[model samples]
Structure formats: structure tokens, C-alpha cells
Target chain A: MNAAAAYLTSFLRASYRDAVAGWNRFWFAPTDPATLAMIRILAGAMLLYTHLVWTIDLEAFFGPHSWVSPTANATFHEVPKISEIMEQDPYRGRSFVWSLFDVAKTSQQIWAVHIVALVTFALLTVGLWTRVVAVLAWIFAVSYVQRAQGALFGLDQINTMLAMYLMVGPSGACYSLDAWLARRKNPRRGAASPSTSANIAIRLMQLHMCVIYMFAGIGKFVGASWWNGTGLWGGVANLEYQSLDATWLAYWPHLSAFLSHLTVYWEVFYCVLIWPRALRPWMLLIAVPLHLGIAFFMGMITFGLIMLVGNLAFVSPESVRATVSWLFRRTRPAPTTGG
Target chain B: METSSRPKADDRHQACCPWPNELRIVVSLLLALHVSAIYVGPFSMGAMGVTSPLALTLRRTYRPYLEAISTQYQGYQFFNEPGPSHLIRYELEFADGREMVTGKLPDIDEHWPRLRYHRHFMLTETAYTLVSRTAPPTPPPGLEVGTPAYESWRQFRDADAALSRAFLKSYAEHLMSVHGASLVRLYGIERRYPTPEEVVDGIRPGDKRFVSEELLDTFTIDIEVVSP
Candidate 1:
């Protein structure tokens, strides 16, 4: 009895130690900011474009008499009163969401706020004072989403998620105007040093992405079509969602079923498989086609592209740096040696 | 494209859990709390009507933080069901005896750049989602009134009715203002997708047979538009 107890205690001790070590290594280890910087440029560009598109009908959608009226918008953001909470109302009240648009009542005010938002997004994209703009970008992104609650989908969610995480790290450490300006000021600075904050931000994004896919996959099980392998057909045959006329997929039922099954399985397992170095690439590769397919075939180009940008969190800084350097080298003219 | 090259000596030294132990512990706790919150959002919104009680509790606890950060609605349930899409069809009547003008919430021709069209598409879809929740489940025959079950259903019905009214009325007033009309009629249209068998049988996806419409509401200019 004494020997068995001792062995059990030893095993538990080793397990706890290993778990703590792994957790610390995963979240706190310093790393290059390259991946975060790349994501900033891409996600910031997406944020800029997304807000720019709002310019076409800014007054109609966000003006005083907008699609979602002020009263209804207020109702959407209402939180449960203290009395209701104390009474244990089963149906929790709406959330207490904040938005800058809440204060911008007039068309002129809305346009002024919007132009500032656009400029902020552009600055974030160019990596100009990214530390400040990244936070503002998130605030603006969330404001737009909260104000126009009815006109949102996955695109806005992913876009805001990327922007939010970008604020947690030094997203403009490299490949940014900030970096160029820094170099011009002091030519002695080496490559951006590894950063613990960068690692934390990337890890958070990677974990958030895993959560998204897990839910997305699990949610499909609720539908009857997803079960009998007819799910892909449902999306493909939907006239409203089709961008490229993929009804041709009707002729290939078997292939359609294969893809539908593959999608669910990939999403469900991504959280697990993505952690292993060997499996991470395969997971990311699968994400490319899956997102691109949605972009081209489903008419949600922005949503699909933003999701791919979120997946870039799984990519290593070294890989991003190497790939970018290779592309630049291929594009630039070769140096001529003195004859 | 991943490389397995060894880190530089300095990078390796710095990578060894560089944060002080106290900071590491603090962040670890926060990280655990955050990840749990993230998991709880969708876990409470479980698939196949299977929400766990634990998930619901966690969701309630984290609701404020999640909302403040605008991460509460990240269900990520993309194409989960892929059911019928929705649109709002409207007709306007002017006071001067002008011919009635008709339009749709998301006329692709008018709403250029697919994103704009998608935004309008989401408007109708959001209306449908909100209105659908207003329908309470039918009570069993001979079920007693004032019981817990009946009270729950009654409360849900009342709450949902108020919510849907606010949403539909706002939309109605917007249409009236846009058309400069005295009266506006709105209809919710649901367009179901064609099945594979239907497609094989030469039926197109956009056939009128698959479309159904219901009158959502009607509004006059006298309906009070709330000031911002």
C-alpha cells in the first residue's frame, strides 16, 4: 500500500510539472514579430477596404434615418437591468455594446467620424504608429459592427477579431513604415527583436481560430443536410449565395459529398491537429482551399479572405520572413559585378 | 514553407520563458480564463439543441466581458444549416395618387459591390431570425395555465413580440422615408434552395415554385418615427 501511494504521487508530480512547463512555453516564449506584422498589413488592408465599401451608402445605412433606426439599435444593445438579473430572468437581456456612432447623430457627424475611421485604418495598414492605431482600429471596427448589427456576417467578426489581437502585440515591428522610419533615424538597429507579447498575441489568435472552427463544424451537425452528405449541395444550389454558378456540382454528387464530409472533419479536428508541427502545415494548406472556395464560389470574398488571414496566426515568423524575402529577391533585378 | 533551422543563441536564450515567474503566473491565469470564455460562447450555443448547463453558466458569467470586447457573437456557424435565404419586398403609395412603386431590400442591380448586396441580404435574414424567435412552442392539450411551463412560454412570447415589433417598425419607417410615400407595405420572402434531385429534373434554383411570401407589416407616414 505504501509503495503504490508513492508511485501515484510521483506520477502526479511529473504530470503537473510537464503541464505547467508546456503552458508557459506556449504562451510566454519570446518570438519574432514577423507573423504578427504580416497579419497587420493584410488585416489592416481588409479593415480599410471593408470601411471604404461603407462609403458607397454611408448615409443610407448609418445616417439618422438609417436601415437600423436609433431606437432599434438601442434595443439591440440593451443589457439586463439589475432588477431583472436579481429576478433570475431566464432570457438574459441584450448585451451592453458601445459604439462611437451612438454619439454621431447627424449625417455630417457620421461622415466626419467615418473619414477619421478610414484614415485610422489606412494608418494601421501602412504600419504608421501601429501601436496607437491598432487599438483605435479595433474600436472603430467594433463600433461599425455594433451600430449596424443587422448588416453583419462572419466577415465582420473575423475582421474585428484580427484587429483586436493585433492590438496585443508589436504588430508593426517589421515590414512596416514604422520600421523604415526607425531605420532611417538610427541605422544601427538590427532586425526587430523577439518579443513575448508577440508570441502571446499569435497564440491567442491561433487558439481563437481553433475555437471558431470547432464550433463551426459542430454546428453543422444540427442540420439534416450535413448528415446525409447533401450539405454541399445545399450551399451550391442556393441561387442567392452562388457567385460563379457552381450548379455544375450537381452533376458530381459523389465529389460534392466528399467535399462536404471533408470540410466538417477538417474543422472539427483542426484544433487538435494544428498544434503539432508536422500537422500544422497540412491544416493550413486545407484552410487555403476551403476559404478560397468560399471566396470564389459562395460570393463572400471578404469573409473568406479574412478567415484566411486569421489562419495566418498558425504560420511561423521565420516562414513568413523567408517567403517574403524569396518573393522580393525574385522580383528585384540582380546586381551586376564589376567587370 | 516552414523551416526547422535552429534559433540563434541569443534568441534561444531569450525564448526560455523570459518573463518573470510572477508575470507568467498572472498571464497564465488570465489566459485560462479567456480561453474558457471563448469556449463558453459557442458551447452554450451548442449544435443539435444540446447545450450543457455548465456552458450556460460560464456564458452568463462571461457575458459582460465578452460583450464589451464584441466577441460574444462569434458563433462561427458558417453554412451550418444552409437553409432558405430571405428578402424584404416593399411597395410604396404616394399621397398624390402616383402609381405604386415596388422594390426589394437587396436588388443586386442597385447594390453594387457584392459586400453591399450582402449587407442588405443580412438585413432580411436578421429580420427573419428575430421574427422566428417570437413564435413560442405550442402548449400540450389540457396543459394548466399559470404552471411553470406555461409561464415560461408566456414570458418568451411576450418578450419576443416586443423585440420583433421594434425591429419591423424601424424597417417600415425607413422604407416610408426613402420612397417619400404616405403608406408602405412590406413582405418577407423566403427562397428555398433547389435540391439535387430537383436540379437533375431540369428545375432551376430560382424557380418561382420555391418562393414563398408573407406580409410582415404595413406602415403609414403617421407612425411616429423615433428621434435619435
Candidate 2:
């Protein structure tokens, strides 16, 4: 009996040690900031463009006489009394959801805040004062989403997700104006060092993406169309959602069904398959076609593009740097031979 | 000439695990709490109406943090069940005896740069979601009226009605303000897509037969607000 107990204790000890080591390695290991920097430029550009588009109808969406006026917004954000009775009121008596628009009651005030938000996003994109601007960008992104909850879609969610994580790391460590400024001040400074914070940021983005797809895949199981593999047909035939007419897919039912099944299987297994180095490439490659298809075929170009930006978290810093360098080399003029 | 001072392979390897043990522990604990919050957000918004009690508890515990970050509503269920699309049709009557003006929420020609159109599209969809409350579930066997189950369902119904009225009224008021209109009427239109069989049968996806409309509400300019 003593022998058996001793063996069990040893096995438990080994397992516990292994688990701790794995956890530490996964979350704490330092990584080059190249991947995070690239994500920042892309995501920041998206945030800027998204807010810029709001300029088209600034008064209609965000002004005092906006689509979702302050009074109506208050009602929407109020905790339902029924939820309170059931002890399920997430916000209790008061709401924590906030936005600058909550206080910007006048058109002038709204426009002022909107301009500042646009500038913050542009700064984040250019990597100027990146740390401060990254945080500001997140605050502004969330503020817009919270205030205009009626006009949101997956694009805003992914935008806020990317912006939130960008604040968690040294996202301007390289490929940024900050880097250039630093080099100008001290000509001998080396490339940006690796950082645990960068790793944490990228890991969070990758895990969050996995959670999104996992839910998305599992959620489809509740629908009969997904089960019968006609889910793709539903999207293709939706006149409102169609950007480019893909009704031709009606004739290729087998191909449509194959794509539908492939999407579900890929999304469901992404979290598991994406961790392995060998499978990671295949997973990311599949993302391009899936997301691009949505971008072109459906009318959700911004949503599809932002999702692809989120997927970039899975790419390694080394790979990002190599790819960027290769593109620059191809773009640069060949060195002319001196006579 | 500028010399590249990139770190060597050995240097890079050495830099991989530079965090002190104490910092690692703190961050690990924080990460554990954060990732738990992240998972709980979607888990609480369960698939197939099968949320676990544990997910609810965790979500409640993390509610404040999630709300502050505006991550509380992270369902991530994009196109999970792409069903019928929605649009709001509005008719406005001006107090100045002007002709009635009529329009849709997302007139494809009026809203440009697809994203703007999408925003308007979402407004109609949000209205549909708010107003389209299903019938309350039938009470379980042996549970008659006035029981806890029945009362709970009744409270939900009442709350939903109040919320929907608030949204529709606000939308009506906006239209009145926008068009100098004293009277506003709003309709929720559900645009169902054609099935593959229907498509093959020469019926277009946007056939009027597939469109269904329900009058959501009608509102007049609030006398109190207009006089004040």
C-alpha cells in the first residue's frame, strides 16, 4: 500500500510541475515585437478608416439629434427590472458601460471628440507616441461602439478587440516613427529587444480569436441549414448581403456544400490545430480564402478584413519581418553597376 | 554606411525567458483571471441555449471589468444562422401641409461607402430584434398560472414590451425631428432570401412575395417638448 501511494504522489508531482512549466512558457516567454508592430499598423489603419467613415454622417449618428439619442440610449443601457428580480442583472442598479458621447451633448462637442478620436487613431497607425495613443485608441473605439450600439456589427467588435490588445504590448518597438526617432537621437541603438509584454499581447489576441471561431462554429450547429450543408447557400442567396452577385453558386450545390462543411470544421478545430507549428500555417492559409470570400462575396469588407488582421496574431515575428523585408527588396530598384 | 546590429542567434535564445520569477508569477495569475473572464463572456452567451451555471457565476463576477472594457457583449457568433434581413420603412407627414415623404432605413442609393449603409442596416436589424419577442414559454406540467415560473415569464413579457416601445418611440421622434414632420409611421420589413429551389425556379431573391412587413409603431411630435 505504501509503495502504491508513493507511486501516485510521484506521478502527481511530475504532472503538476509539467503543467506549471507549460503555463509559464506559454504566457511569459519574451518575443520580438515585430508581429505586434505589424498588427498595430494594420489595425490602427482600420480604426482610423472606420472612424473616418463616420464623418460621412457625423450629425446623423453622433449628434444630439442622432439616430440613437441620449434618452433612448439611456433606456437601452438600463438594467432590466426582471433581470434584477432574478438576480441576473449584470449591471446591478447602475451601468458601467460608458462613452464620451454620453457627455458630448452638443454638435460642436461631438465633432470635437470625433476629431480627437480620429487623430488618436492616426497617431497609433503611424506609431507616434504609440503607448499613450494605443490606450487612447482603445478608449475611443470602445466609446464609439458603446454609444452607437444600434449601428454595430462584427467589424466594431474585432476593431475594439485589436485596439484593446494593442495597448498591452510594446507595439511601436519597430517599424514605427518612434523607432526612427530613437535611432535619430542615438545612432548606435540596436533593433528593438524582445519583450514578455509583446508575447502576452499576441497570445491574448490569438486565444481571443480562437474563442471567437469556436463559438461561431458551435453556434451554427443550432441551425438546420448548417447541418444540411446549405448554409453557404443561405449567405449567397441573401440579396441584401450580396456585394458581388454570387447567385451562380446556386448551380454548384455540391461545391457550396463542400465550402460550408469546410468552414465549420476549420473554425471548430482552429483553436486546437493552431497551436502546433506545422498546422499553424495551414490554418492561417485557410483563413485568407475564408475571410476574403466573405469580404468580396458578402458586403462585409471591413468585418472580413479586421478578422484577418486579428488572425495575424498567430504569425511569428520572424515570419513578419522576413515577409516585409522580401517585399521591400522586391520593390527597391536594383543596385546600378558603376562604370 | 549603417551597420546592422541585429541580435545573434545565441543572444536571441538568451533573451527568450528574461522575466524575473516574481513578475512571472504575478502576470501568470493576472493572465489566468483575464483569460477566464474572456472565456466566460461567450460561455455565458451559450450556444444552443445551454449555458452552464458556472459560466453565469464567472460572468457575474467579471461583469464590471468586462463592461468597462466594453467586452461584455462578445458573442462572436458571426453569421451563425444567417436568416432574413431587415429594413425600416418610414412615412413622414409635415405639419406645414407638405407632401408625405417615404423612405427606407438603408436605401442602397442614398447611403454610400458600404460601411455607412451597413450601419443603417444594423439599425433596422436592431429594431427588429428589440420588437420581435417570441411567445412566452408554456409553463411546465402541473405549474398553473400565478406560479413562480409563470410570473417570471410574465415579467419578461412586460419588460420586453416596455423596451420595444421605448426604442420605437425614439426612432419615431428622430424621424419627426429630421423631416420637420409632426406625424411619423415606422414599419419593420423582413426580407427573406430565396431558397436554392426557388432560385432555380426563376424566382429572384428579392421577390416581393418573400417580403413581409409589420407596422412597428406610429408617433406624433410630443406636445410638451415641441411647446417648451
Candidate 3:
């Protein structure tokens, strides 16, 4: 009995040690800031572009006289929209505070607030006081979403999450003006060092992204249309997104079903399959093309691109560094022969 | 570059990402709040198994702050329907008594640089986001269809209908005024068009078979708003 108890204790100790070691490696291992920095620039550009698009019909959508007035927009959060009697989201409630709607009443006020938002996004892209700018960028993103909750799509949601996550990381660490300034002062600051904040930020994005896919997949599974294997066909054929009439897909019904089922399966399994070392490459192969197809076929190119870029958080910083170095070497002019 | 007395790799690793333990705890807490507030709603908890009272408390506590963020996560419940029900059609009657009908609108079928106005479609869809609550007001106690109790339900529904009519009148007025019309007529279609299961079997778009001639709701925009 003594021998058995001693063995059990020894086994428990070893298991605990192993688990602690694994936890530390997963969470605290030093990660290059370059990956987070890259996401910052891309997501920042997306931010500016997303807000700039609002300028197209700014008055028409955000103006008080527009179809959905400010009061209606506010009520959108609280009650089911009368027009949309079929689709009701019980989870949402009326937002109590609105930074954008409360402050800007007229077009000029809206434009003024918009211009300042654009400037904030521009500064964040260049990494000036990134810590401060990141927070402001998130606020700007939230304000737009709140003011025009009716005008939101998947891309808008993705942009908000990316901006939120960017604020959490040391995203301005490398490939940024902050890095250049730091290097100038220290002279020995490595361009590709790890930042704990960056790692934490990336991890949050990673986990959040997994959750997103899992839900997206599960939502698809629950819908009767997806099970019938006609969801993709409906999306493609919808007149609202009829850029290139993919009605030809109707002719190939089996092919359409295959694509639909593939999407559902891919999304549901993404959270599980993406974690394995061997399966990651496979996941990327399926994911990258899927979003690209969404961009080309759905005419939501920006939204698709943003979703694809968000997936890059799963990539190791080492791989990101190597890709950057390769691009630089290829673009660099052939070394000039000494005259 | 320093050639002598250079720090070893271990020293460099320690310095590279020296994130203090305290900050990690703080950020982790914030992330938890964020996740709870945004994703742990009544509808979304099916996958995460977040039914506990503690989770409910955390969601209620942080939900206000989360809702304030721009990153609204209603989830992409798109293309999950058997078919779209709302088909908005516009009609205009000129002072001369000539009438015109159009299915195309600036934000729906024809918007410049198509991508820009996709949000218009999304906005319309947002108006119809699926809330699991009952779509119709239940009949009053001891009330059956065609009875006075049924009329009470009808009144409740009409109240909602009036509100919707006002919102659409503002938009339809904008559309009709552009077409030089004096009177505005709008139609809201409630359709359960054939599902993917019904039509995916070699059905073509030119067939014009999916759209049924069933008129669900036909209401005139009786209110007057700005023409432009």
C-alpha cells in the first residue's frame, strides 16, 4: 500500500510539472512583435477605408432625416424593428449612450467628427503614440457602429474586433515609426524582438477568432437552409449581392451542395483543427481561398480581405519575420558593383 | 555591434518580452469582460455552455460596456433562412392619375459602386434580425380568430404596422418625390419563397418560379415627409 501511494504521488507531481511547463510555453513564450505590428498596419488601413466609405452617402445614412432617423436607430437596439417582423434579435437592447449621434446633429458636425476620426486612424497607422492612438481608434470604430447600427455588416463587426485587439497588443513595436525612433535612440534595439504585450494581444485575437468561427459554423449548422445544402446557393443568388450572376451554380446543383457543406464543415471544425501543428496548413489552405471567394463572388472584397487578415494571428511570428525578410531581399536592388 | 561581453541568448530572451505578471492578470480580466459582454448573450450561449448565474451576472454587468463598443457581434446568421420574406416594392401615382411601380431602388437593387450600398441591404436586414420572440402578439384571453379578442390582437399588430409605415413612408417619399409623383404607395412582401431544397435541383433564375404572387401586406404611405 505504501509503495502504491508513493507511486501515485510521484505520478501526480510529474503530471503537474508537465502541465505547468506546457502552460508557460503556451502563454509566456517570447513572441516577435512584428506579427502584431503587421496586423496593426493592415487593420488600421482597413479602419480608415471602412470609415471613408461612410463618406459616400454620409448625410443620407447618418442624417436625422434619413430613412432610419436617430430615434429609430436608438430604438433599433431596444425593440424589434417593425419592418423586420420576421427577424428579431432578443439579445440586443437599446444602447443608452451614443458618442457620435449625441455630439453631431447636422451634416457639418458629422463631417467634422468624421474628419477627426480619419486623422486618428491615420496617426494610428503610422504608430504615433500608439498606446493612446489604439484606444482612440477603438472609440472611433465603436462610435461609427453605434450611430449606424442599422448600416452594419460582417466587415464592420470584424473591423471593430480587430481594432479592439490591436489596442491590447504592443502593436507598434516593429515595422513602425515607434521602432525607428527607439532604434535611433538605443542604436542596439533589435527590430525583431518579442513583446509580452504583443503575445497577449495576439493570443486574445486567436482565441476570439476561434470562438467566432465556431459560432459562425454552429449558426450555419442550426439553420434549416444549410442542412438542405442550399444556403450558399441562396447567398449567391440573392439580388442584393448579385454582382456577377452566379446563377450558373444552379445548373450544377451537386457542386453547389458540395460548396455549402464544405463551408459548414470548415467553419465548425476550424476551432478544433487549427490548433494542431499538422492541420494548421490545411486549415489555412481552406480558409484563405474561402474568404477570397467571398470577396470576388459576394462583392464584399474589403470585408473578405479583413477576415482573411484576422486569421493571420494564428501564424507564428517567426514565419512572419521570414516572409518579411524574403520580400525585402527580393525587392532590394541588386547590390551595386563597386566602380 | 558589441564584440566583447555580449549578453547571452537567455539574457536577451528575458529582456525581449519581459511582460510583468501583474499586467497579464489585468489584461486577462479585461479580455474576460470583453468576451462575456459581447458573445455571452441569450442566443449565443448554446455553444459555450455559459448558463451559470455567475456568467449571467458577469454578462449583465459588462454587457452595457460591451454594447458601447463599435465591434457589435450579432453574428453572421446570414443565408440561414428558408427564404427571404420582406420584398419592398414602391409605387407612385402622378397628379395626372398615371401610376408607376418599381422594384429597383437606390439602396436595394441599384446603388452606385455596388459595394458602397451593400450596407443599405445590411441595414434593411438589420431591421429584420432574428429575435426568437413571438412574431405576432398573442390573442387576448378567451379570444378566437374573427372574435373581438382577435380585433385586440389586430390593434396591437397595427400599432407596430403604423410605426413601420412611418419609417418606410419617409424612404418611399424620398423615392416617389424623385419620380415626380404626388401620391405614394408601398408594399411589404412576407414570403416563404421555395427553400434551397426545393429549387437547387437544376432550377434557373430565368425560370421566374420562386417569386409567388401572394401579397402579404399592402399599406399606403399616408403620411407626408420631406420630398427630397
Is candidate 2 or 3 superior in lDDT?
Answer: 2
TM-score of 3: 0.78
Q: TM-score of every model?
A: 0.93, 0.93, 0.78
What TM-score does chain B alone reach in each candidate, compared with the true chain B?
Answer: 0.85, 0.84, 0.56
A58-164, model 3: which lDDT tens digit per residue? 77777766656676666545543221222232443344445665779897898888898999898788887788899989888888787775567778778888898
Q: Which 10 successive residues of model 2 chain B have the least lDDT summed?
A: B219-228
Q: Candidate 3 chain B TM?
A: 0.56
* Residue A127 error, candidate 3, Å: 3.3
Q: Per-residue lDDT tens digits of candidate 2, residues B117-184?
A: 99999988888887876344564577679887777666666667666666677778778778889988
Q: Which of 1 and 3 is ahead in DockQ?
A: 1
| Interface RMSD per candidate | 2.7, 1.7, 6.0
If you assessed candidate 2 against the hidden native complex, which CAPRI class would it receive?
medium
lDDT of 1 by residue, A231-257 (tens): 888877887788888887778889888
How does chain A of every candidate compare to the true chain A by TM-score? 0.94, 0.97, 0.87
By summed lDDT, the worst window of 10 consecutive residues in model 2 chain A runs over: A79-88
Off by over 4 Å in 2: A81-85, A88-91, A337-339, B1-16, B48-50, B134-145, B223-228
- Scoring each candidate complex against the real one, what DockQ results? 0.51, 0.52, 0.27
